[model samples]
Target: MSKEQQIHGLRPIIEAIENGEEISKIYFLKEGNGVLFNELKHKAKQANIATSYVPEEKLYKLTKENHQGAVAKLSPVKFADLEIILETTDMTANPIFLLLDGITDVGNYGAIIRTAECTGVTAIVVSEKGSAPINATTVKTSAGAVFNIPICKVNHLKDAIYLMQAYDIALVGANEKASESVFESELNKPIGIIMGSEDRGINPSTLKILDQQIKLPLKGTIGSLNVSVACGAILFEAIRQRMF
Candidate 1:
């Protein structure tokens, strides 16, 4: 589907799903509530659809009309689950996946996936709701790398991380505010990195549960790097350490 065809909102999206139209995922504001919304979520779960809960600004961008604080977009491709991706063989070894906590910008999402494919990361996991829509913009931004990479959608990013931890995988979360540095950390084992959206970094609840929270070195005045660039830098470092 065309990127422009990706419409987002509470009522419109839920109706689409009820009518049996395929949707990539639905985004709900953190404080949002209603019978319709609740029913939609229940149905989506029953249908094995992914859901993401995010802050307010994200819903505003999809449309100015009465979006009711929600946005729905169609993913050009389907997303898989972390466990399934991990179990699959012959694709890649020493699996490395990226989980975006609540990134909503299409460009950043695409760029990260591009870097993931380029750096040999096995798959990218995005929370069913808050991540960018795998629309034409994302496809274009990714330079078609989205097609080559395996992107999965999970019910909750935390549960997905827990699944990895259960498998003996180590998690590395990046935040400008984090004390530890990524360059100094050990990432040779099966790994997953959690990245936050533009407005806020990873959720504190998620951060508190991670194995390691590492920060990228920033000598500049801004003291922050775009999430995509930060992910590429970290993923490449892992590739370098593994290759050599």
Candidate 2:
């Protein structure tokens, strides 16, 4: 995270959240409470920004300047508007999009983005909450591919799914228990592939909206593939299908 990404003080934090800033998380003093604190918490929750109650020591360690009992981390990457992206996309080209559902690991997020860019994915759609912050670590792990791809951060993943469907884009989710394998599915079409977080997989509700679900074939003893690796395999298959 860059110094510019950290916003401190209650008023500033609340204003940032209210202004639709991409705040990754907020750390507020655990013992702090009052009208100001309540207002700050309310704004953060309304914007789906993560919040944590920490000790005063923790706040002091974050900065030498007064934080006024609160601090917030902003995302390093600017988010693209889904509507604008959808409007400008050439539908005839069979564009590919990656939808991340609750993916919280920055390293995995970065790797997946790098692979997506390599596979010619149109854009990456992530939820405003429960997704990894686009920080320096993610950018470094992606080998700068973060800058090469468009990232659409929306208030809700389901809404993005609906918008894509309206555009005639097929939604394919990668589920461990899906009946078909990635190779068995046809990928030569405009599509969005949803990859879930490592812990919970795709949200059950989100899964219902998918046009179809496919999983990687695990012949070995391993039960699951790393999220990033799974994403790479699925994307490259599409690339192979589209290129050949």
Candidate 3:
């Protein structure tokens, strides 16, 4: 973590949040207690910023400067507003949106972004929490594709899903147990495809709300594929459908 990528001290962090900065996450000392710290916590919660309480040692490792028991990691790229993209994008072109559910690995997230951009996805959406931070490593893994694509962070994945539905874009999720295969699903129209974390396929609540669920057929003994690989397969299948 570079000093340029982090904002140290409680006051600076609070000011950054007030200024609508794209903060990836914040670390706070477990033992720290003060009026300003409480105010910071309130503002962070209101902004839906991911935060963690850690030991002072963790803060020291993050930065040698006087952190005042707080440090915030800044995102490498600015996040796009989901509602704005929804309103401005041409739905007639069958724009495809990729929604990530609980994807915490920066490498996988980056690879997914690279694949999405290559496949002509309109944007990528993630939850404000549990999703991977768009850090330096993510930028490298993405091959600089992160900046090329619009990534929207929402307070909750469900909220984004509902908003997409309001836009009349079909919502589908990638699930191994889904009855329909990705190749067979209707991806020729404007759609939002949900990809879950590597460990958990998809949240049960999230899976229930999707307009449809899709799976990639597997002949080998492997039960499932990597999230990024599955995303590529599904996205390309969508492209194939739209092209023909």
**TM-score order of candidates, top first:** 3, 2, 1
**Per-residue lDDT of model 2, residues 105-199, tens digit only:** 99999999899988888899998778888888898899999888899888899999999999999999999999998999998999999999999
Structure candidate 1, residue pairs in collision: 8-72, 51-129, 52-129
> Which parts of model 3 are misplaced by more than 4 Å?
none
**Residue 15 of model 3, lDDT score:** 99
Comparison by TM-score, 2 against 3, better one? 3
Candidate 3 pairs with clashing backbones:
none
lDDT of 3: 0.94
Instruction: Write down the TM-score for model 2.
Output: 0.93
Better of 1 and 2 by TM-score: 2
> Which structure is stronger by TM-score: 1 or 3?
3
Q: What is the C-alpha RMSD of each candidate to the true structure, in Å?
A: 5.6, 1.6, 0.9
Q: How far is candidate 1 from the true structure (C-alpha RMSD, Å)?
A: 5.6
Tens digit per residue, CA lDDT, model 1, 100-141: 999899899888888988988788888766666787889999
Clash pairs detected, candidate 2: none
lDDT of 3 by residue, 1-244 (tens): 8999999999999999999999999999999989999999999999999999999999999999999989999998999999999999999999999999999999999999999999999999999889999999999989999999999998899999999999999999999999998877889999999999999878999999999999999999989898999999999999999889
Instruction: Assess candidate 3 and give its TM-score to the true structure.
Output: 0.98
After superposing all C-alphas onto the true structure, candidate 2 shows an RMSD in angstroms of 1.6
